[model samples]
Every structure is written in C-alpha cells, then in structure tokens.
Target: MSSTDSSQLQQQQQQLAEWKLQRLIKSLEEVRGGGTSVITLIVSCKDQLTRTSAKIAEELSVASNIKSRQRLKLYKKTPPNGLIILCGEVGDDTTSRGKERKLLVDFEPFKPVQRSFYVCNSAFHLDPLRELLTSHERYGFVVTEGNGCLIAEVQGNVKKTLFRLTASLPNKHRRGGQSALRFDRLRAESRLALVKKVAEAAGEVFLQKDATVSVKGLVVAGCGDLKNELKARLDPKLQNVIIKMVDTAYGGEAGLDQACDLAADALAGVRLVEERRAIGSLLEAATREDGAIRHAVFGTQEVTAALRLGACGRVIVWEGTELEAVTRRHAETGEEKVDIVAPRVAPVVQTERDGGGNGGGGGWEELQRVPLIEWLDREVAAKGGELTLVSDRTPEGLQLVRGLGGLGALLRFGVQAEVLESFEESKEDGGDGGQERETRGGEEGDDGDDFF
Candidate 1:
C-alpha cells in the first residue's frame, strides 16, 4: 500500500481501537453479575502473557475445588495491553456436559489498574470494577392498592421486596337509603384507615431501612385510587422518593413486576434523572444569588478551571460531546504534554529534530479528538468530585445542554454571586446559540424540548 493509504489505515485502526475501548467501558458499566456464585478475576499479563491463560486455568481449578460447577470465562478473546478479566459463573449447570460451555461475556483490554491479581468471589465482586467505572446507582419500586409492596433493585434486575402490607378496604359502592348513607360513611372511614395503614407501612420501610437515604428514586404502581391515596398519605420522605406513578392491573409481586416493565425506561434512565437533579440543584443555587452558596459554574472553560482549582464538587456534561486536545512530545528528551481545547479546532503542530542528520524527531500534534464525557469523568473522579453524564433522555438534561453550553459544575466552595450571575447572564445570551449548536451538531431528531 501507498504511504497515504497506510496512514489512513492507521488512523482508521486507531479510531476503531478507541471505539472498542469505549464500547467495553459501557458494557462493564452496565454489567451486574447475578447469582451468589458469580466470580470475577483480574490478572496482569505484563510479564506472563504466554502463561496468563494457564494461570487463569489454575485459578479456576482452585476456585472449582471450593465452589461446585465453577466455569470461568474471559471478557475478551485476547488480553489487551497485558490485562484480562475473567468472570465466572460458579453454580451454572444449564449447559450439558457433552456440549461446550458458553458464558455471557464482555472484555476490556485496557483498564486502570496498577497490579495484576486473582480473586475468587461469589456474587460477582464489583468493587474492583467500580474503582474504574465509578457507577453508583440506587433504584426502588413500589406496588400498592388495598395491598402494597415495596421492592428495591439491589443489583441489576434482582429486586428484594423491602416491605409488604395488605389492608382490607371497604366496598366502593353502597345502596341508597339512610342505612346505606351510614354504611357509606363507615366505608369512607375504613378506606381512610386503609390508606393510613398503607402509608404507615411505606413509612416504616422507608425509615427502618433508610430507603430514602439510599434509593435514588422509586416507581409506584397499583390498581384503583389506593395508590394515589397512599402517595398522599406517605410521609414527606417517602413521597419525595417517588419518581414515577403508573396504573397497574394487579398488585403485590405481579404488580411490582408489571411496574418494573412499565417503568423500565425510567429505571434504565435513572442516571438521567440524577443528572437532572444535580443540574437542578445548581440552577436553584444560582437563582438564590447568594454569594455564600454561589458554588456553581457552567460552560466548558469555567468548569475546567474550577476542576483544576479543586473547587469542583460535581461535574456534569452532556452525553454526546467531543473535545479537541493537543498532545506535545519533545524530540531528544521524549517529554510529553496534553491540553484540552475547543471542539472542531485545528490541531496545533510543532516539530523539532535532534542534532543528528536523521529527520526523525518528536513534535506536537494538535486537534486530537477526545470524548469530552470520558475525559471529564476521569477528571472529576480524580479530583474526588461526582460526575454526571446527562443526556436528552430528560428535559432538565436537554435544558442544560441547550441553555448552558452542555457543561456545568457544582463547586466545593462558594464563588462571588456576581460570577454566578454572569454565568446566568451568559446562559441567557447564549441560550439560543447553544440550542442552535445542538441543532447543527447534536444527534439528529433532538429538539431539546421533548420529554423522554
């Protein structure tokens, strides 16, 4: 192939590699190994690539000795950068002995870890993975009527019903007569009592287990008006946790299952809800215009500056944003540097040759594109700040992206009220600009106004 063709091929390969890495990151973020027998193993291939497979096999052998029917599976076909993750299902026996075992798998060739180690754990140990992925999610579910049940997504689809209550409610209809009027009044009182009982049950679950503290949001569903009445009667803590309310045909476990299915979109988009809340908090604080609590900043430059100063408490960025960064390298010393820049800008180039006659030398490469969300995620985490990836899946997220330049931050310390006021002013001035930018560069069909 010609030099041009070779260069194009290399660039394509790099793009493909980056894409694969991103895909793996997303997969790992979403994966939650079910069952108590799930095992996760991370091994370093730095010096033992040749023996890595055998080392893994040995580890599995030892694990099998302790856990029955243990089957080890690699996330990737080949280890990337001398790193491999082995996730095993310890008690899986669905595969026939005569047939080859097929395991649900995903791979990440490169992970942020310093050393190689093996761990045999039940319940798919995730702390090791969370260190790199930084996914903290909490979800809850509630199904109620005359009866009520509350479940939480402890992990993945595995839900543990935290509370269950059954109340005998009075009949809905009564015959017309003076006696019937008394019966109707009695039934009204009975229904009211049932509502109180259901609310008390929910409050007990929320308070005893501290569900409000851990559950990010909840879905409530049920037949009849009982669900609404329960909501009205619930304590403020329980009431605030409700994310969605749906009408269901059943109650109890079946109702919970139906609620889960109906609210799958909300549950799956919990991150979006979180981002909305975070952004809303920032907006609220900004509106106060209180200098002591004016600890919020928006726009890319301001957020980056705040993060660098360690003032960022949380970083929020729109889901689909690309940023330009510059990478510089020295010729003789082999020193390197990188700096973030605005998107779509041409890369800066600086070349230098050593004293030798040869043309080979280090140079600065400009316009290297990076996923802004990924970069900000790492930056915020490294700075001990929470990172929220907001998308158009939520109205608040859309507003953030469309009105606030697709980036914002909650600071650790307060800034001058004028500074935040300026941000709001800039937002007002550039709100249309941001929307136009999204229209031209964002995902097609995104109106920045529709509710998800």
Candidate 2:
C-alpha cells in the first residue's frame, strides 16, 4: 500500500474511535445522582475472560457520564455458559481467524424513583470499552493470573470497594478445570448489601453509635383484620416506599399467617424475602407509594399514614404496639417496607366506655389507635426528611390493641372525631342530634353508642 493511503486510513480510524466514545458519554449522562440510578455490568470471557472483562468495565465507567458521578462494578466470570451467555463486540470476532480476542459488553440501569431495575447486555470493541470504563485512552489495571472474579461499586459519586471476592482452587477439584465454575456459582448466590438506596436520614439511624443494622427478610401479608391493624397502627407518612398491601380475610395473632401467604406470592424474588434487622431501616429508606395519608385526629390511620409516608415531623406510637413489625409505603415512590421496632410499645391509657356495651361495662379503649410513643418514632424519621426513633423512657407494654384496652395519648391537639372518620357527620348540639349513629352491618342499638 502507498504511504499516503496508509496515513489516510489511520486518520479515519481515529475519528471513528472519538465518535464512539462521545456516544457512550451521552448515554451515561442520563442517569441522575444521590442514589437514584444504579448500573451493574457483567462480562464473561472465554480465552482471557477475567482480564478482558476487567478492562472493559474500567472503560465503561469512565465513558458513562452519570450526573452524580456514580460508581460502577464489573464482575468477571468463566463458566460453562460463558460462550452463549456473554454478548459484546470485540476485535477478534470479525477477523478471518479467532486469533485476536474480542470484548463483549452489557449495560444494566436502575431507577429508584420508578421502583424499576432493568438489565441490558451488549458487546463493544476492546478499544471503546476501555475508553468508556476509564476516561483516558489507557489506564493501568491489576490482572491476577488465577483469580476468576471481582466486584467493585461506586457510591456518593465516588468509586469505592463495597466488597470483592475471588475464587481459590479447592483441593477436591484441583486437578480439573471445572472447579472454578462451582466457586463462581456459590459466590453469586451469597447476598450482599451493595445498594444503599434508603434515605440518608434512615441510613444514619442504621449506623447509630450503639445500634446495629440487621435485615432479616421481607414477608407480605395481604389485607385482613391484621392488615387493618397494621394500617391503623404501623402505617407511616413516607413516600415511594417498597411495601405492598393486598386484601385477605384472617385477623388476630393468626394475621401473621396471612402475611406469610402474601410473602409466598413473591417467591420468584427471593431477595425481597430476606429480612433486615429492624423495621426502622426499611421505613427510613423506602420509596413512596400512590396513596396519600388522610389526616384524622381521633384514630391512628391519618397519623400512621403520615408517619409511613415520612411526613410526620415528630411522632409517638403507644407503648402497647412496641417491637411489632410495621409495613409502610411511600405515597409518591410506592416503595414499601417493613419496620421492626427497636425499644418497644409504650402508650398511656385513659378510661372510656366500649361504646358497644349497653351497661358501659365492656371496658374503655385508647382514644387513638397507636400511642403517642409510636407517633414520636415516626416523627423523628420524617426529617428533610429523616426519621430517628430514640430510646423510650417510659416502660413497654404488650397490649397491641388500644381503646379496647383503655389506653390513649395527649395528642398535639384534641383529636377531632371527624378527622379520624372523615365520613362521619360532625356532632352538633341541636335537638335532633340525640339519636346515636350506627355502623354498617351492625343492628341499631345492638352495639350501642358506648361500644366503639
């Protein structure tokens, strides 16, 4: 070939490389920051899978123009499915002979705001992959000869190592090549907390000086009497949380059984079932849901909803329901979560007729469903919003149901009954107001005005 022709070809190739790098940058810039977007990249290399995959990941990270300067982790694997499962454009694929290795790339994007997590896998040339993972045309990489896999993460706009695990050849399979495959599979199955998408304030409580954070698992309990109680008691005012409330029939302590059933429905998503340490962590970080909390003064629904939605600036739930599990969803984000109480339930009791009994002997009930103590918990979490539940000074109690137990709170203000039951007509002192109101499906005077 003539010298002039060769020089022209080199110039054209350089232009193409620049164009591809620009395209990748544009694509990455679409993701917002502050834990809103998450990206995961997995690469399977056959010949030099580990080295090649690492190189590509570094390039992609640099190329991605995320708003928050997010972190990116590249996982490497060499499994039996490496050939079929991996996809990406590399230098070797288009050549006459597979002499040179090609790089395959894939992209996965997550939007916490949308409550959606998606995966996209594709291939790219080695030159471009390296350019995108790291900004510069070339960056140094650590390539271990025997290590099969590695994982890295970026958070708060800075790349940091959350955790990295490598497979060491086990003696039992030392003689064969397949030993690495078993190790890779086992590592993938183990759970890790890479995504800390929960709110900042919520995250703080989990990291308290003395308190430890634990995520047990998530169990869904459909709507029933227990669900109602949960709604009435534990519901918060947060938005975009990750909890789901369905309908069912059972009630009482057995209500938890129905929760197990609901949780089973999500068997396909085993990760959701994994329990965290306490309900506080979930509530502090969960996204918002579609429904908004209706403010009612006489009952717990309004207040509980406010707390669950992360709206209550300061809250206090009665001591009776302490240490109970609460399921709260965000009003805007539809993120649902289960909250485990740290201290316990502690609520003040007041004497009042059952309203259902004729002789006023059924016993008094709490003026509010959740006690002031519980409200305090939700209030602390709703700041800027964050919720921080402090250790309670009052003693704890076991009585879950209030009102029926004669416990109540001295709310910020005297709760207006209309606020609790928005549907009920306001009480008036006129002559025609003497007749008592009756609940649906209940006979007139059967439960009496003093029973509820």
Candidate 3:
C-alpha cells in the first residue's frame, strides 16, 4: 500500500480501538457493586495449555471452599492463547433465596496477563480490569550515554525495564592530537551503536507483543547530543513512536520514571482532554450569550426543561451532586401520596396509616427512588445527546458547579427572542432585584413551583 493509505488504515484501526474501549468502559460502569455477596475472579492463563485448566481448577476450588453456600459454575470453553478469564456471581435476589446469577463478562481485544489469580468479594471490583485497559500504551524510554530502558504501561500497571542497556565512550584527551582525533571518531561511532541497540531493543519488544496499536509513543532523554543521535538512528517504525526528548538527572529505570513524571500532562489520555474541552465549549457559549434564554442553559431547572423538550444536544452535570425527583401516585379514592426519589434509591416503607385510626389499613407504599443523575444519563442517551459528568478536579469543572449552578446543557437552537428581550427589560428596570427575579423565573416552572 502507499504511505498515505497505510497511515489512513492505521488511523481507522485506532479509531475502531478507541470506540471499542469506550464501549467496554461503559459496560464496566453499568456493573454496579452487588454489595458483599458477589464473587469476582480474574485468572491469567499464560502458562502451558495443560497447566491452564489445572490452575483454574485450583483457584476455583479455593473460591468454592470460601463461599460454600454459593455454587460457582465454570464456563468450559477452549482457552485461546494468552487468554485471561474474569467472572463474577451473586445470589439472584429476584429469584428464590438459594439461586445465583453469574456475570460472564467478555474482555476481548485485551491480551491475557502473565500471572494467574482469583478474588472473591461482596462487590464486583473493576479496578484491576480498568488498570488492564488503561495500561495498553507501550512507551519506550532511553537515556543516552549510560543507561536506557523500555517501559510499558497497560491498564495503569507500569512494566519497567522490558529491556535495559548501558554503553561507555572512550576518553578523547587520553592521547596526543592524532590519537585524540581517532578517539573522537571512535566515541561518535560507539554512541551511534548504542542508539541503534536501544532502538533495536524497543523494536523487539513492540514487535514481539504486536503492540503497534497499543504503543502510545516513545521518549528519549539525555544531556548532550546522545538523545538526538538515538533519535536519528532509530528504525523508521521506532521513530514513528518517539514523542519527545528531554534532559534528565538520571538514566535507566530511574530515567524512565522521571520522563513519565515530567511528561504526565502531555501523556494524559485523549478522552480526558476532550471531555474538558467539551465542558469549556459549553461554558464559553453560555458566557457569550449572557442571558438565560439562549443556545445554552444553566442551572438544574433550565437544563431539565431543555432536556424534556428534546432541545438539548448535550448535558453537563457535576459529579457527586445529589439530584432528586419526586414521584407521586394517586388512587381512585382521591387519596394522594408524594415521595422524593433519586436514581437507584432503595425502596422504603411509610409509617402513616391510610385511615388515621386503629382499624385503618397500612400506609401506602412509596415508589422506588431513582438517582437524578442516573435518570439524566438515561434521558440524554435516549435523546441521542452526550452526557458529561464533570468533577471538581479542574478549574473549569469546578466552575461548572460553583459558577453555573451545577448543571447545564447546550441546546439544539436558541430560545425565542421575545423571552430574551423580556429578561433584558427586567434586568434594566429592577437592577439586582430584576436579575434575582430572572433567576427565580428560570428556577420555577410555568406554574410558579420549583422545577423537579
């Protein structure tokens, strides 16, 4: 294929991988912790095929022994080369008391790990899985002159020293003029050889593991011209992976850590940066409009209304906000009941009796509460809009909560001009009072009640 075609193919593959990863993350997020009764197990099958079954059987035996009441069923299937198995099970509360439901998750596209292990717990913990996914980026680090090492971060786990090498140069001033010139040439050749060796080692690891897609990039570090020499000598494939070069105090494994630490911001994943950018865009658009009735809406009530009308194209919510909605039910006898709810809110009993007397029937049951954020997530997805849960970690994210009232949305189109004019008129006449009224108007529904 032509060079351009090859580059395009690689880009397509990368986009596909990113989409798959996003889907996997969403799937993992959907798996709520099942309290303490759930059993989560992950075992690496990187050994000989004969030992793989035996290893899994041994681990399963231990898990079964610990959770004797819960019968663990192993899904018997042909093990692929370099395959790891992650499975979980919890008592099926919806069914009979003794029954259990197993969660057999598919973690494809991720290579099997090098070790074997199992875990039993009350909840299906996903930290290990997340680490496995995030650490797929293979980065080669080389500090020229003395020390160099290759490091790979997969799913967050850092594998230091995939390969290490050291080289010493000859002293140039050890002899007279002609001897000194010969020594200088020899030193240059030796440094070039060292660079070639480092590049070759990186190629070997990346090629052996088929890490072309997973490799994020490479970093070269040194004080003098050695780093540039290494870069110049790197194989074409290795050269493509080299991201940046820096001067560092250490070489070898320590240099690897230092490079990663210094370049942490640059190495922050693309998804995180994109998320921040999207939030910033919403903020900018809102600020430019400078009114409540514009292409962007802020505060919980306005955003909720925009969502209800299918006018919102994106929903931005502050992480960890306790948003809620009330669900009310009425009977044929004209008796009414109200219950405050949020997404995933557990059911509760009401103590008030129906008849308010000794012989009265039991109080009406309150509907199951769902968390407001969870409800918003479903709503945004249903409307084919994006939902971003921004945290207080960054300044812009913090402003989304503290400055913009914790919730906002970008609309498909601007609101009516008349509404904007009315808001402006109110602001002019009442000053602070008018602004307060406008805010209250936005907070209240058409019926003058607080919007849910």
The TM-score obtained by model 1 is 0.38
Clash count in backbone of candidate 1: 3
TM-score of 3: 0.44
Write model 3 residue lDDT over 1-452, tens digit each, in one string.
Answer: 79865664454344334344444455445443244444444445444544544544666554453342232223344245234343454433333544445554443334455554445555555665555555445555666555443444422223345665655666456666667777778877876677778767666765546545336676777757767876787667777777778877777655655666566566654333334666878977776754545788887556655654577887877655654543332222223332323333433322323221133433434332334565666667688676766555555677787888778898877775465455444333422210211111112222111111
Steric overlap count per candidate: 3, 117, 15
RMSD to truth, every model: 16.6, 28.9, 13.2
lDDT of 1 at 57: 62
Best by TM-score: 3
Expressed as tens digits, the lDDT of each residue in 268-343 for candidate 2 is 2221111111122233322223234222221243444333333443232322232333333323323333333222
Error of 3 at 107 (Å): 10
The TM-score values for the models, in the order shown, are 0.38, 0.16, 0.44
Query: Ten consecutive residues with minimal summed lDDT in candidate 3?
Result: 433-442
* Model 3 lDDT at residue 70: 31
Ranking by TM-score: 3, 1, 2
Task: Name the better of 1 and 3 by lDDT.
Answer: 1
